[model samples]
Target: MASTIVSSIGQGTGLNITEMVDALVSADTAAKKAQITRQTNNNTAMISGVGSLRSALTTFQDAMKKLNDSSAPSFNAYAATSANESVVKVTSGNSAVPGSYNIVVKQLATGSKVASQQFAGGSSSAITSGELTVSQGGKSYKIDVANGATLESVRDQINKELGVQGISANIVNGDGGSRLVLSSTTTGAGSDLSLSGIPELEIDGTQQMAGSGAGYITAKAQDAELTIDGLTVKSAKNTIENAVSGMKMELTGVSTQTNGVGNPTSVTVAQDNEGLKKSVQAFVDAYNALQTTITALTSTSKDENDNLVLGPLTNDPTTRSLVGDIRKVLSEVGSGDQLTTLSQLGINTTKEGTLEFNSTKFTAAMNDKKLGSEVQELFTGTNGLFERMNKAIDPYNATDGSLATRKANLDKVAKNLEDQQAALERRTESLTESLTKKYVAMDTMVAKLNAQANQIKSVFDAINAQAKGS
Candidate 1:
């Protein structure tokens, strides 16, 4: 506002002092401001480029992790199939040998359940509260009931006191008013559930009504009984793992028995050629995507008008170094039984820095017994392809890694630019203030000179007018 007043004053002398001062100040600061803006924009782009590169690396790593199913890598994967899915379902790991087994499910494992005698009142009826001991599979826990506990409240208390140990209680209301039902998730023989407490909830046959009025066993605990290759096997759960080597079976239903013999379901274990091919193809695709991201960040393109447009990280030393490191790992040779490098397994890097996978070659390699193991070792063994690639990327993507340090430095640069911008603003304001004061003083002087000249002209005009009149 003061500058505006000064400018108005300077205008009285027919000099645009405000415009002249603005032109001078802009000329003096334009170059520095442009340079700072250009550098700040470039730094921001570089930071964003770093993040994109990191995200691409993380995505590639996820694809690689899928191939590593366990601590001991098993790229030579296996699959198991059951002839009758309604009878059983099977899954296999790489450690399983290719073979066929006859499986017959005779019985499924079930948990035990006990029910208290029907209460004369409904589920909301009050029950005697006392210390109750719940026993399942020989494991026991005691629960203290509040004096005013109802049937439903007692059931809730039992569930609250017992967590994942698998003991639970519920009230079943039927023609027999309401009964407290106790159930267990622990399946198998010798795991029956029993309770000893007030006569209303006892099931151990100790109370006078234990035989009839007390609770009675509704379902008895029993183990899953099955036959594998003519041998009987027992398990506490329907899903049996230890019955087979590197394979597990989940029993869905019992097989139909004929003349005292249960029909058997055929289970076959074999190499999963299709699954392996898909995994390798996924790896190739992920790496190619990462390569494309790197190219977009580090290469330049042309605009519609034929002007060159620079990429975010164009000519960046760190990006070039990272690309070189990954390429070096991909080009390494390996020692294997029948394969040496990725090329032997139908995987090769194209000139554009992306991998190409040959499905036919991969399938043939997997079909060969000796080559299959070699292919597995090439990708999952010590210093394998993925291992080396992950190692090379860790330094750049880790929390305190190269990319983090670079971003921090760029942030500092941005902060410094902010400081520079502030300083420039202060300098410009000061220059404007000084120039405005000078112009205002000059304007005041001009006004005084004009005033004196007008007074002199008035006196001279009066003299001339008097002479003319004479």
Candidate 2:
């Protein structure tokens, strides 16, 4: 019956009721749908903009941290280079004075290797069970040998127990059967291997201890010997540190000439001016990137139709205040004899509100003998410019700070918008269902009245036909 009514609906009303119902529903919900769409777009864009702003702030802070490192501050950086890298390598710190040094690598440090007396019975030869004490490099360790332990077992025990102490033992096969060889990683003089209570394994006179068994000294321990500017220097290791203040020198090869005098490898230490400049440039670039982000967030522009388009954060006071705070810090002067502010370092604010780096001016200022060292005080230490800049940005960029709170609020607003949009869709669906039902009923009623009228007209036509036939 409902299908019949649906088929006859347009027969009576001569109208597309389904199409009309859809149009009515669309008209009823258009304004609210459009409003929700616009607001959702706005909230989503705002959330994204806040994320971008926070990321930019973090990047700028990273740049600040690079310059403000308490250890090896960027401004006080020094470079040490060796003329002959094959013979020597050098590293310098801020405390090193700028000067040239004639370095000569005479001999590197050596460790001890000892070979025990050969056993005719080879690796499986029986060894006495006792506590064996091994000493080397001012350190000692004792290993317990079980009864009925072979030479191989003792060697394994020595390697297992003494390996961590920089001493190891291995068995070598020669004409005299298997000989146990013990070696030490400990270098420098008076650090030769010494053994006690293991006469079966000991050779003779390795350590020259009175009334003590010894081992064959395959290699003797020796200290590393070198010279700086013809001044003699000795070290326990190839890497020498205390010879020069704030400098570490590594001897790689011997450079003793035929005339009995060692050839010199020139090492030069200087302030790292170019490296500091690069660091400064990176700082400037990071700040500029942050400035660009802020400008994009707070500035307005024209759309394709000439309509004014507002940025996601155009009306946000926090963004503007944050930029103002950073600018205020940058503008302040510092207490330095040769440098007071970043402007003196050739970092100046442009009309666009971003920093412009003048490399030539920076180079000249950094090269000035009086100003070069003084510049270190400006960008380093507790009162440095980078530290100040970091402090200025801390309030906004920290966790639970202004930007985080702003982002949280924007996210909440976005969630609210989503809820509103869902509620609107439900209302639209309810309204559409109601309107469709009412229009369908009205169409069915009109169709029934037309059917009744057709029945009456047909009855009259039949009567008239009968009369005409008579």
Candidate 3:
């Protein structure tokens, strides 16, 4: 009987037992189908969680990068301005005639003390009848310095030397006949020149220093001072571009060459900390949700005999391994100038395997310049916490990632359950058809037996009636 029951359940039977077994098989198929559906749902949730976590991590990393970049100083503060006018001079030579003439500075060249003394003045003329020696290239030529030497005599002698290419002597209108002056064509720190062998002669009414020639004008300005987002900043340059990353400020009235100055200019610098705070909060919330989901999936209900619908996946080695891997990835550090660990940056793992943020501490650290700089460094280097962590979690991307792998496995299980359900359905249909045919044959046999019994009874009654009449 037991064998029969087993066979009837295993194969199609011409009885109601087969139908009953079919119903049980169908129920089993349904349970498995439901299991696959649940797993699919879980797969979707896990993928979403991983994606949200990755995005949050990226946001934190980007903020740290900007902070690190902003901490460094830059150069933007120097300018040049014009100072005073100069005059050129020519004296007398022995052979030249004394003549009052207009002298124009054809070209003005300035050289260092050493280079200037090495080259002699080119052409010369006698003015005021004085003997003057023309010195150039460390060589001096003795021309007759007398009262009658015209300015033209001095010009000609200085022009003769090869090293003296850029200097010219000119006579302009002054108190004592025409006054001699020297000038430089170049401008800058390197252009100041010194002259030797010149006596008391007034050009532009300012007494020229004994050795130094016409002074060049230079632009002067001071360092910039201002407050940005309530933080004071001092920079030597005019433009504060890198004071904070993604922000650049230009001082309107302040420049390297400002003429009128009291306080050159002022500007306000601010950052959107509120928006950043909200983003961080979202990350924390998402992380907590993921943690709760994992906990629920692994936990058991109070009912002892309840169906173990999720099966071994709740404690399966494969599932546990994946969870562990993901957790490890989230705990990793970032790259570049990131001085603070995830915990220090307000992200710490709770007992329930979720992340918690210390809002007060984090806000304080951000406002603190020194702490902020250190935190920025932790995330900005090649081996920084963010970079490493990002690398570790890269396998969970949308296509062919870790989460995708899990989802594929779940789909395969669902397909297998569907195939089993189809096979069970065919068996149930076959058994139902065979049972109906068997029941119909039995009913025909029973009807024929009843007809024979009825005929026999009628014959006996006829025989008795004949006997009694005799």
Candidate 4:
């Protein structure tokens, strides 16, 4: 592939110039190039492996959040149940104490409902315009009826002004004619319905279009009455809360018989054991996942040829130390009297470093009067397993924690690889240029020697011919 002069070197000196130069250049750069490729590949694999480890650790942290946080749902949560759902219903919060209470419904508060006199001209009859004032809980509002307004339109006007104030108006039609009915939206003594400033409609149903005075009042407002353990209680509304410490009781219906007394309804509040059990189980599963990922990353396998194949992080001592730290925290005994460690609650670690829960023993722990209280504290308390593990992991997962530091170190490794690869490439290029110049020089020298020898032989032949002729 050289000029005619360089190609002639092979013919003149019997040397394979092009092939030799190619072999020499390849040999000179092979070792360094191979080292660069191997290191680059290892750095890339480590980045991927560490990324997966961080993701798994993040998941474990999320599970820990539920167990360590006091506000979260746990076994300490309470539920309220009512013996007579028809008469009463109850709900409780975490603050509710576990106990039973008897409640009696004496009366259900009723709102005021009243109707007006029928219109002589029916639903479309015109009525004299006037101000209709309604009073409830000491709050009063007025509905203005324009002259020539129909019976139905009058009802709509009243509703429009008082709807937000717990008042409703409707037109009721009967044999007499179209009647206007007024009612309260809420049930309570303070929410009574009454009318004024319409005399004709006062005593009968609808007021006379010609006369004016005050509207009718058919029913009065009343308060709800109930008893808790023979203690009378009054409420402006049917729903009662804070009366039983976290228990919210709702009055459904009025008492059927007696002097404001009926059959007692038993309401019970207790701790939810199942909820706490599930939280612990979730923690166990998360721990196992962390264990599995660590084992796979640090493990080794045998190839078909009986050679050893190392895991991605087989050479990472930091990962091994982290795994050791996790195992140590899991086996720790918390600062609790009755139940100290997870083992006390029947959570055990296997030979492979995975956790398992024994259902029978766990049930026993939850049912144990004294142990149960301590068991709940073991995982949810300040120095509990969940809290301790979360605190330990926080340092490693923080912005400048171990995981973050490791990732930063890997980034440095990647950058260094790039620099090394670029430097090697430049060196290989310089070496190739130098080798080409040297090989071409050697080819030129060999070609010049061949040309000189050919000229000398020609001159010698010519002299021999002359001698023969003489």
Candidate 5:
């Protein structure tokens, strides 16, 4: 006796469920990996934005500090001391006689010293009581020197040597030519020349000295005391070029006849406080622009996505961080009792983080004897505010500094992203392989089920036919 058994499963189905599931899983994995990569990019961008804001803020603060410091705007000048020394005297011109006359010296020409051989011929001496000749560029000059001639006579002979060299030889007229004098038409190191033969006897009334080339007497302005707005300024240069910008004062009415020693000339320097005011205002304007930029970066707004567009990272945290950093750098605290803060120097910030200048307040601060001195010390000291600020931001400079570090970090992150992407691609390939195998198995199973169903139907049809024939 045989028992009947029933089973149902197989055939060419409309779709393969197993293959579909595998494909969906692979797609989900790829999308997740892509999402992680995008987040990394966003993080890198945010870091860059914050770094840029910090740098700009630092620069703005530095400029403001320099402008606020009162000492930064001061100027120096040179004053004339000697009235007669200021004038050049042409005692004896080539065409004029040697006479005493009050001659104004527009420019003083420094004298030079030249050395040349005085040839002499005799039975006892190699050469004696002969003329020494010098030639250059087809031009020559003869110097007459007597045998056993003194150094002064030899210098005098060479002094008389004349040609393209445009040099004049003479005794320092006042010093009885005691000092041999050589003068060049030009001023420079190459203008002077000297030549020697034997023994190089001391000439020019001085030890035989090498030619100093061409040189000049540094005619500096005499020190003069001038009162500017009740402030006395002493300068040693003739023209007061910096007494006021664009306005130069020439020292006139100088007592040319008198030997201007211990003589004081009085002149007034008008104060241009208006010009100083304008400069301060310009600095304020620049500072305001920097503040605006920082504010914009840190602001956020809601978008259609119902998400914060800029977020707190843009407005609160980054901007606040920058403000804190700037304030810390500018604030002073030490035993030296130097500058304390911008406000102490009359540069106070508003609620909006922009600087405001109060002239009355600033003037009062400057007038404060102790405070003013302290403020001055801050700008020129061992550990001044500017020095500290520069030290802080120096690393951000383009060459092997903070900026370089940031750039290096960015490169490292980019490389990491690339590596992650490559890893994801490998994962995806593995997923694809698994999905393909699963789909192939599903396809085979469906085919076999359909064949089994067809076989069962054919058997039932043949059995029915036999039964009918019976």
Candidate 6:
């Protein structure tokens, strides 16, 4: 009877059939979504792993950089001091050799200065609109003065043009309202102040204002007089360089005291040992941190529940390979010096694959003359351990390099999966629309057929009743 009723109803049950088809479509789509989800999770994990590896490599690189910069006071640098800071102060560079020197500053260098022929006032100009020429040591400059320009404006113009080396303009208020004064920027006899182009002004380094036809010589340009080890030396300026190999002495004042805190017999330049020791320890700490990060990423451990837990990068082959590569570099012997290996300086690896520095052994090595020199060479030499390791690790840590390549590839995978998911969703939507339309058509047709069948049945029953009554 159900089949007969179904035959009469035709596709009236299509909605139920469409609903079943919709369930099937959803199931298929769910499988595709599951695949996309799995791919996303896997790619995310691998990307994170690469990030960890990169961070580790960068930390190690920074540690290596410290060993390369010997100019830092913490590494093979020189420290120079002056016994008398009041009279003389000293600072040493990497090239300075350890030595002692006795120095005496007799006179400080002076630059040429001359007060201009008194002007009317500080802001007043003798000549309103004119080009003034100032020359010094065969170098000349022409300064253009604006119409009705003041002496102050002329001063600004001269300074702006840097009119002449060692020639600076100034104004002073004296018995006269203001006078234009020009001085030298340098402190030596060769650097002398001079002026020209204006007859009202006449200045010279060696001249008296009222005597002769020359202007007043306010100050004379002179050289600094000093003695190094009793050998008289003359410097054009106060700052002296390389008088003693690798030493630059700046003379501040004349010698007024003997060798002591106020003045000493020697200026000493020596190596700073404690600073280098601290640098080595810092390198050890950085190296250990890198090692710990690698171990944590590549190893497995038991969780709080005592269940075995895998590290984020435990399955990554590249991370494991990097560890092996770094270990190989660390263990290699350096051929340039007697301090060929890290173990000689007490930098040893722990059982857990981390570095350990033995301070006692390192200090002893630092004190040994033969080993100390070689040890410094080992770290700073051209093919030193730090140098070699830096080369090995550079490609991996550089941007868009090894680790970045893996991340980029994973990014592409994720994008492709996303595209696939979008296509599947559109296909599902189209399928749902097609099923709904087909079901609606079937319901409409079935209802029309049922209506016709009922109308025909009523006609047959009416005819049969008429025949029976007759």
Sort by lDDT, best first.
1, 2, 4, 6, 5, 3
lDDT of 3 at 281: 58
Give the per-residue lDDT digits (tens) of candidate 1, residues 1-470.
33755644364487888787788788988899898899889888988998898899888888788777664344656778999999999987656778999999999998877788878787888888888888877688998887988999988988888856888889887775777887777888877777877767777522223433654455467899999999999999998885888787999999998998899999999877776677678778888999999999988889999999999988988888889989998888865656778887789888888899988777777776446545566776777787888898888878888988988998999899889989988878888778777877888888999999999999999999999999
> lDDT value for candidate 1?
0.81
Model 1 is weakest, by summed lDDT over 10 consecutive residues, at 204-213
- Give per-residue CA lDDT, model 4, range 284-372, as digits (tens): 89899988998888789999999998887886987877877778888888898867888877899999989999877877776764365
Provide the lowest-lDDT 10-residue window in model 6: 1-10
Clashes of each: 1, 1, 80, 13, 21, 3
The candidate that wins on lDDT is 1
1-470 in candidate 3: lDDT tens per residue?
22243334222223444455446555646666576566657655544544454455345444434433433311101111111112221211112222222212211222322111111222232334444453333434444434544455554554444225454454344322333444433222233333334332212212222333232112212245544444566554434455543334433332222354222222222332343355455556755665565566555555567855452236645446545865785676544243346676577888778888898767765665324434323543456544554465456533576656765775676576567657656655565455534544454455566667768877887788888888
| Clash pairs, model 2 backbone | 203-214
- Please provide TM-scores, in order, for all candidate models, with all chains considered together: 0.82, 0.76, 0.44, 0.62, 0.49, 0.66
Q: Which stretches of candidate 3 lie above 4 Å from their native place?
A: 1-246, 249-266, 270-282, 303-313, 329-338, 367-369, 374-386, 396-398, 468-470
Model 1: clashing residue pairs? 209-214
lDDT of 6 by residue, 1-470 (tens): 12221222235543465446568678868887788887788777777877887988887787677556644434554667888876677766556677778877777888767666666555665555766776555566777766777778777777777744646777777664566677766787666666666655546546545422334355577899878778788988888888777667788888875553223346888765566677778878888888888888778899899998777789687677677778887899997545788887789988999888887887777676435445555765778777777777776777857778877888898889889978988888777666555556677788788889989999999999999999
Candidate 1, superposed: residue stretches over 4 Å from native = 1-3, 6-13, 67-76, 100-102, 121-131, 146-150, 197-199, 204-218, 229-231, 256-264, 300-310, 314-341, 373-392, 426-430, 461-470
Ranking by TM-score: 1, 2, 6, 4, 5, 3
Q: After TM-score superposition, what is the CA distance of residue 219 in candidate 5 from its true location, in Å?
A: 17
Clashes of 1: 1
In lDDT terms, how accurate is model 5? 0.48
